[model samples]
Target chain A: MSENIKNWLLFILTVAVVILLSYLANSIINRKAESQFAYTPQIEIGAHEPRNVVWGKNFPRQYESFMRTRDTSFATYLNGSKLRDALGEDPRLVVLWAGYGFSKDYNQPRGHAYAIEDIHNTLRTGGPTGPGTGPMPSTCWTCKSPDVPRTMAEKGIGEFYKGKWADKGSEVVNPIGCADCHNPETMSLQISRPALVEAYENMGKDIKDATHQEMRSLVCAQCHVEYYFDKNIAGQEGVPYLTFPWKYGTTVEDMEKYYDQMEFADWTHPLSKAPMLKAQHPGYELFTTGVHSQRGVSCADCHMPYQSEGGQKFTDHHIRSPLDNVANSCQVCHREESGALINDVFQRQKKIKQTQLSLEELLIRAHIEAQKAWQLGATEAQMKSILMDIRHAQWRWDYSVASHGGTFHSPVEASRIVSTATEIAQEARVKLARLLGQLGFSGEVAYPDISTKAKAQAFIGLDMDKLNDEKETFLKDLVPVWKKEAAEREAQMPIRPVSSRE
Target chain B: MRFSSLKKKLLPPPQWRRPVIILLGIGAGLAIYIAHIANVGSYLTDDPTACVNCHVMTPQFITWRHSSHREVATCNDCHVPQDNFIKKYFFKAKDGLYHSTIFTLRKEPQAIVMHEAGQEAVQSNCIRCHISQVTDPRTAAGVSNHAENRLDRTCWSCHRNVPHGRERSLSSVGFHLEPLPVATRKGSFVPAWLDAQVNHTSN
Candidate 1:
């Protein structure tokens, strides 16, 4: 009714409206921040904190989920976290790797959680009491643990590599975790391995300048790429320094050229007497050629999709074969039916296996022929070209096979590598025949009887009894010591819990 | 004359004015509330149901039902979120909203891109649950080492087939036969007799 009353009411109404709007906006902003910063540091995470539980106090979801890599139930068509004895299914491998430790025991890879256990259980790393006593170098544990980076930092990189695997067993206990790839302060992906950084450096590139999209796959490349130990680095002598043979390039041909230039050989073939190169798993390199990668799909895109629970969301920490979860891994990118996507993977694998097996048979024959030539007193000059051919052929074969999941990861490239291997092997056999004929021997070189794994071992002249006996002795005698030492060391590490009220 | 003129000049307000104002207020409130609810709902159901929403995933769902991890895990259990709650939630909210919106619109991603981050997430969850009970010392160690080095190495490095075994058919697990045992239209189980008959006839 009065002018003053009307003005007072309007002022109050305006204030109420402004207050409500501000509260709503603030709520929205707070929720966004909470989702990103829910994990407050309960206790200060040391730079070298190897244990994930320590990190768990601050980030429970990640730590709890990261711990799940131990599940062995999910299996895919081509890849999963379960261990399968590959040599048992195909005994031809024993003959192929006759002089190598792999022929003794080789199982399909499992989840990252089993990295430490698998290495310890393998007979390849012989039992030893101290440094330099075991068959395997300390570099063997490099890819298995985050403790590796911590150890490398404490002891200079070269010094860490200058010993046997058994010497560091007590120190490297934790499995792969966050510290391996993420910057603790920013939670952004970071390269922790020096080898990857150094490899980039050799190419005149800076890792810090890598694009964000590249970091997704680059993180996996930290461990999954092909690598070898270079004991001849100028100042790194006497140390089996881990290195990627990427000086020439990242392609199969590039790596082959680099290895050839260095005259690098993993081991001399027992039967063929050829200098050989072993291709470590090159999952990243092969994946780069896949349709998905071509489409700019990072490994993190399909394998680590987002998840929600209890009004909160988080990244699922489980990593295994993509076939295990096609809907999440492939369906996100491919419109094809689940069956169709799986069929695509299987088809690629089947086709690749066809060529791979053919190459294997050819390689077996080549090795036998080379041995026969050497037995006939062939000179190094006479066997030179044949040996080189054998080396190149096996390298190609190993490149395709050792790049685990390469068929599904990059079917076209895998097929090409296998075809190349078949051609090289065939050429080697032709050369071997000529050399044998010149030595006054003729006709086909009789293939060895390697129908069974046991028969193959006998053919290789491996004292199975002695080897097995030694493996058993090492496990029984040395494994317990490593465990005890590890327990004591872990006990010494400080673990401060967060104050609940805080 | 004056009282009669005043009464005639006074007119009642139109009946629709007050009702119209009330109706407009209610309609505006309903529109705003609906928009808010829709935004929140989109994030929850987006990709969460994408795997099962499609008919193609039906058979796989059946297999997943019989899977050992069925009780404790879901599709997301093995596929998304490699590590960290903050990162996980950010991803889920962002991707969930995107997927939910796209899936709701009946659009799915073409050419699935395998994410190492997603695989690492699934692998981490697997080791967390199963590592302690692992009987094999070597396997246990590998599991431990992998967990510690989660950023560098994946769990699939050693435990290659823990989830689904190899790609081979169940028959490849030693159940060899000419064909999978099937039920006839008469609801009778196909026996070894039928299997042999089919094989012999084909040969």
Candidate 2:
């Protein structure tokens, strides 16, 4: 009886150990599979594929989240993903940009999915009824789509930027998508635009040395940076070449010094006639000065944070304001409740806006003051120093505001720039007072009645009625043809299913 | 006989008493020496220079001095609790202890950002001073939370540049001599003398 009992116990213990071993082996295998980011290819993505639908077949989750860029419901205190009529909101901007194309119609940019459509619809494109009709160069399409890189590869960089913006309308039909910032094969972050590489080259640094983390922000910097159309490159004359003014540095003072030395102007202000500089979106440069960047946080760290969906971890692609998802973005690093974090951002923005608005008022007066100086028979010699001051003052103001997130990114820097601009503008007024006395008319130049967008535009002598009429015709007649042509061309490409599973 | 009696009463035997007196005297002297070296007394006053005694705070002091609030306020006014005497000293003592430990260990992070207790004091001070500006309906934090769990808003979240410039990094640590830094290194992070002393002691 004792022998039987011992045998039974031994048998049961062996069985239990075998079961536990199998369970451990199964878990190990499952974890290995998950770590591989396992996915089977649905269709082979072409090396130069620009159509997002082709990539979507293999990456449904990423593509679906990316498509949420179509949503325009979100708005914030100052800016948003909505198609906001900026000039309508603040007429003073119309006078500030006087002779620039932005003055014609400057809408705060909508979602990235609307990139191609919005550019085609804006009046600033100047009614491209047929090819080569718009005022802007083909360089305007540089940031609009992945198709730009593909087109540049085929047509060559200088030639890609040689023609009018409308000339490439049929070709750049797709809005910004996957190929703009990714390697097709490995899906690693990559810079598709040559301008960014060239800018880095000019800065005496190699873009190749950037780490995977740095590449996350560098990809966004490829488009969201201050750039100019350098028309006088040694071999690429009249190409309206895209160039970043970083030879000196990325600061306002540095870029201003570079532009002044080169005698480059975006457009001559018709009202003030000061050689003007349009501050393009310098989002990346301004952000580097903030506490976020100093703490080694990348743009994607906040803008495209990691999301786990269906047991798979990937960067969330529905990029918009951080205020929209403060829990996932700001709250990840900041322990302050969402309300506290947002209140902080709004406070900084509102405070900066107060000084910015004051700068705008001062700028309007200076322009009118200079205009008065010119009208009262002030000679070019006398107006030279005064015009330089206006240019410097206005450049500071634009640099602070045009970066869009500068107030939140680096409020101290923005505040300092605006406050200094105010001082320079007051000095311009002081010099104007002296100059006007010599010209024999010193009565305070009557402030123009620019109480509304229409009045402001009219004060700046813009023919908004004609511009709107042309825009209507362009959108109704030409845009559809371009879209249809692009669709037909894309449909011809073949996408075969790969018979392999990873 | 009188002289011998006076000597016996006034002074103890040299062997044991001398050493005992010496040990207690050394202990008290060392305590006062540390107190003087740490500039502990300055922390009790409203002087901004007391902060820069730690070289890590040089940048914040320089930035504050150049700010618009330089004429009006000092570091303690915004950072220290001001409800009453007891709470104020208690908070300072706790904070100073933590800071000294971190600095001595060379374990401070690059950013040197504030934590909960520091944040609470600053928030209360901001609301106290700028009550009118904060109470404005347009900028005020409303009672509604939209189902989101969060604490109420603080002023510095918006007014980031108040008295101190926005920088909070070790890289911003300037080498200003005035106000007399308690500790300064000329070459590497650990001064040559300190490195030599450490090696000698370890050996």
What is the C-alpha DockQ of each candidate?
0.01, 0.01
**Can you tell me which runs of candidate 1 are displaced by over 4 Å?**
A1-41, A498-502, B1-203
lDDT of 2 by residue, A1-502 (tens): 6979976996688567656544444443443343232233567787779988788887777788889989999998888788899889889989989989888888888777898889988888888877878788899999999898888877777778888988888899888998888766656667788777777767776666776556778888988888899888767767788888887778888889999999998988887799988998988888887888887788987887756454334567888888888987999778998999999999999999999998999999999999999988888889888888889899889989888888998898889889888999999999999999998985889998988999998888888888888888989898899889988998887887765434
What TM-score against the true fold does each predicted structure earn?
0.66, 0.67
Q: What share of the true interface contacts does each candidate keep?
A: 0.00, 0.00
Model 1 per-residue lDDT tens digits across residues A32-149: 4442333235665666678777777766766776777888887665557778777776778888888888777778788888888888777677657565587898898888888877
By summed lDDT, which 10 consecutive residues of candidate 1 chain A come out lowest?
A31-40
B59-121 per-residue lDDT for model 2 (tens digits): 677566544465456788788898898988899989988986676555878667889999999
Clashing pairs in 2: A344-B157, A348-B158
- Candidate 2 lDDT at B69 equals 60
DockQ of 2: 0.01
- Residue A78: error of model 2 in Å? 1.2
